[model samples]
Target chain A: MIEVSEAGLLRRRSVVPALLAERGDMLVVAGLGAPAWDVTAAGDHDLTFPLWGAMGGAAVIGLGMAIARPDRRVLVLTGDGEMLMGVGSLATIAVQAPPNLSIVVLDNERYGETGGQRTHTGMGVDLVGMAIAAGIPQTMRINLPGEVEALRQAIHTSTGPLFAVVKIDPESLPLALPPRDGAVLSARFRGALLGPAAHLE
Target chain B: MAGKDWPAALFALLQAHRVRQVAVVPDAGHAALIRLVEASNEMRLVPLTTEEEGIALLGGAWLGGQRGVLLMQSSGVGNCINMLSLAASCRIPLPMLITMRGEFGEFNPWQVPMGQATPTVLEAMGCAVRRADAPEDVAPVADAMLGLAYNTFRATACLIGQRVLGAKTFGIAPQ
Candidate 1:
């Protein structure tokens, strides 16, 4: 029941690091705009996708990975604004009930990547409540830096489908990350997934 | 890919087309396919909270260099009215493979209003619509719709008709 509106940008920036430090290579992060920055900062290492512009695509990709490699963990990094754009997938995922899926929504209450043009998530649309309504097995709502470790623990020992709403500031961007497009990173991810050592890679 | 197996047909069709990522909102008609895709390592199934979220996911999936599809019930189509506007405005090529809910032989009252409005909404949003009246027809119809959506940069629909014979969910919990 944590409303994201309660937090500032810098305070929320810690979610990315918290996830990566906790999950390591066990997760795949995807989405648009600032959340990508979150993904890169968390990886400290780097990430790639073959994308640009398509907003809410990460959750599905994460869902796919969750189902394909049930042994491995998958996390979708998303924006409240981007997610509001692609809501139907929720109902679909709920019914499919993939146990490995964890949809982590970085609710900043605005399309920080889209010049702050307002979003439905900002106007009292409870995203955590919505995920629960959509049938996510577990839902976590937190808007403070202090809650990151607990979230990390939940993700590590998680028996999902878990929906986490980490209230972050819309302006948080990772430092020292280079720019990469969906195509460049996606090629690498594809190589990573399809390569000979896919199990070991 | 049998007559009573729309889900099989969907799986084979998507597999053949090399569709790497697929998205959907849960619906009785689409549940089986979602489960099958969820099991496939080669394909990515994204279960979304809304039809528009699937659209957005497809946009990002495509941006991430992956081919994508979206599935939803006819009633959910009504919820996507504004999102269709977002797709059109963003010029994102999102082709949706949706199940029809309120047409002939329909039973769900919840589907009637939006089911009736499904094609109209797509048309109004400048997306092209196609319907499938038989289970066997879904394969090629879906292929053509995806092709049209990708190549032409226009959203295409493969609407599932009630007459298309298949395993009906009837709101039953999947076994």
Candidate 2:
């Protein structure tokens, strides 16, 4: 069970699973560290390509997936620190506006990997506002436990290049790491997506 | 001569290879080819805010069964150092077409340091680096880079020299 305060923070462990519930054929790109663990904890599918590195690249990778596979939904799960590094990508994504793409920032407001240091979001930087300013058609600032369902629904059914910032409780949890080998991860993902074509070229 | 129409020739080569995505951080040297890619119905031109985004985007494109190429200026190479690790580590087939700056033509002082460091940096990151000093060399170098990248699943870069792109000139303001 998770509790939401007036300060508006939800547990990452709960919110991630809620959002990924019944994730039918969605291709997911998870950022390095906690987001990667978060997605793996939800369930490690061949469809989920969890990054061990490339800290700022999660959202753009999702953009490429959305563009390449218009028939499939693409979701990027990342943290506030990672998202800030690649903030410039929002402008590029806004212009492309791939309807199948959705980027969710789990704003724990701290870099959980680097000894839980305070990130810009902890100091009151607004990721949702940045996304809105970048012209993403749908932007969500999800703060309460009750609001998780709406986000899950929106992810399942929405006309979007949507951006959502979930204010997550900055509590470090035990590791749930996916396979660390990038080549293996890549081959599995490509094979799952492209089938025989992946083996060819 | 191949030199006179290498941009078009290069675009045709990319098309022949079925490069569905063209990722670029717009550079004046790539203007002619960018126009061709933009006008093509076969490819989608993705304008990136920085060179690193192209690296990640193209990596994802490959994951989704589409081939992509990145075009950037030499100075932008410095921005891609950390991100290039993704391509190298993942063994993603990344073919980068880079235009040289800060070398040759005696131009801006700021661009020189990065321009000089470009090849060494890329090589250090485990990317195969190639050079094209003449217009005729551009297509061949790019073709080889594409082959090396796709066939071997390696990160490769073809640095088109400043002479091939023609030196950028400085002058008085145009009214």
Candidate 3:
């Protein structure tokens, strides 16, 4: 849970693009709703799997991908509401401790899709604290624009299971939706990672 | 007709299927198989805080070109209801081995509700559900479940009946 005024939080649109800038060969799993839009706005790629409605699954999905391909980095970009729903997964990920995985929660402190209901983070639930307590070796709470670069660098180079919560201002933005078909998304991702013939398997 | 060897036989089946990851929520009914998975050099045992994570985890594993399975009890199946949509929507090949509880010879009254509803709920969510009441049927049924899942990219589960798993007793400890 987080407790801070929305006075100086980074804008999500600016922050997501910055986090994804110069992204090369990194496999991304975006959480449902706004985080999905945020990633799509940054730029959609075959390697990116933007979830339509697996509300609490982004991190663990990255965990599976990270475990399967240790050579590639996996990033899970999600929102605070989604992260809280699957908070127990932090413990699961920590135990696995995949060096190639990183999770970044975009904390707007509101369930953006559900008519802006205040999430626990708005009332001061520390997600980073939960991550640390769950035994994740690296944890960061990014409240500034400069910190995003550090988080991005960590995603590409750090030995992690790293967890970061970027505190962003809750401004409902225009939808940048990815393809709604899960099969197509899954097929494209697999085709890019493996080959075009891989999905047929 | 098999002896008390279905757990080991089941492990053999998983190994034969090339199941590289075992996503499990610890259940006493699954203890023997869990022990085998723990000892196997070829399998990565992922202990989950809850069962739902297994659905997404295995889906990701499949995305990265690895096969996996989930092992849990009936109660945990309830936790996986919403997450099962990931498998259904993505056409993820999810094979699950679930040991039954709160059905036959169950001493705990609390286990009954979910246990009775397990198969129905799974079926409602588009899982091809099967059951094995005898020791000999366990491995074969599971093999069929896995075959259907991976071959068709469908989520399937084999519910190992309480009779096969041996129901939990709540009586006083033996002196």
Candidate 4:
């Protein structure tokens, strides 16, 4: 729940690349549903995986990977509407206390899934407020580029499950993904995390 | 075969580890345990939209390296169809504490379908269903089921019938 103008969200879109660059062995879950927060650059780097029909369940899936591969970092790239759909996930995540999980929400304040229905998230719901109440150790909300200095500092330096929200614009930049199906992406994603032996096991 | 005290004992054993998160999809049969879960602040309650989500979450929490339990009535097994695929493919061991629904002599017409499907559904997915029929068996069975679910990384089961979790519902509370 960082309150920023729609344009502010657009300017900070590049931060996605920076976030991705800093973390090693972390999986970023994404789909057409997520706002265009430099997903173009991310896809350019071949770094996103789309899951099944569940729109807001990325963090839940990411949690699975974190538990399976305790050695690596697991990050979930999600939206506000999806987060709200599985709101109970927050309480569950806090209880698990996995320091390897870092959830980056590109909150544009609408259900971008169905082509933008207005949502309570954009209506001043204060998601950070929800995280705090749910018992996350740290909730970082950033509206400006410089605020992300702290966000970067927090992610690279921190350990354990952390909640950080970055406000983005509803209107996004041009981005396109491969014509590849969900299966290919899932297989590749799972293979990357759990090698071929994982399949046999 | 069992009595109300059985569910209480199972809850107390699960309650032993500071069981902080419980995910429940509502069912009248499970209402008592749900109420017990909510009554304890140490155990935060996550009431999901469907039992499938509850299944997904229990696995998710375990992966996040945390302990999570799924609470649901037997009928929810039908709702868990596709999700079982995700769990199997991921090889996540989920230990679900189910309040069995629609079994022999179940007066509610709705419980019959999924109640009948319960055993087959769990078996088909390779989930081991352990029934706790009386008060005495509740704790040991629950502790064993919890361990198998977490340690085995496959879905472990506690299929609690009417007598164990509580007596059969007469459609109203007994005063």
lDDT per residue, candidate 2, A1-105, as tens digits? 456644557989888888888998899999999999998987899989999889789999998888899999899999999999999999999999999899999
True lDDT of residue A97, candidate 4: 71
Where does the lowest 10-residue lDDT sum fall in candidate 4 chain A? A31-40
Fnat, one value per model: 0.19, 0.73, 0.74, 0.20
Ranking by DockQ: 2, 3, 4, 1
RMSD of each: 8.0, 2.3, 2.9, 7.1
State the DockQ, from 0 to 1, for candidate 4: 0.18
Q: Candidate 3 vs candidate 4: which has greater TM-score?
A: 3
lDDT tens digits by residue: candidate 4, B49-154: 6677666655555443446677787888877766676556545656787777676456677778888888898889778788876657766787888877656657
Q: Candidate 1: list runs displaced more than 4 Å.
A: A1-10, A43-51, A117-123, A170-179, A196-201, B1-175
Candidate 2 reference-contact recovery:
0.73
Candidate DockQ scores, in order: 0.15, 0.82, 0.82, 0.18
Clashing pairs in model 2, backbone N/Cα/C closer than 3 A: none
- Ten contiguous residues with the weakest lDDT in model 2 chain B: B166-175
Residues A1-201, candidate 3, lDDT per residue (tens digit)?
A: 123346777888888888888889999999999999989998889999999987788899999999999999999999999999999999999999999999999998999998999999999899999999999998888986667788889999998999998988888879999999999999999999999777677
| Consecutive 10-residue window with the lowest summed lDDT within model 3 chain A | A1-10
| Segments in model 3 whose C-alpha atoms lie over 4 Å from true places | A1-6, B1-3, B172-175
Ranked by lDDT from best down, the candidates are 3, 2, 1, 4
Interface RMSD of 4: 5.4
With candidate 3 superimposed using the best TM-score fit, by how many Å does residue B80's alpha carbon deviate from the native? 0.6
Kindly provide the TM-score of model 3 when superposed on the true structure, using C-alpha atoms: 0.96
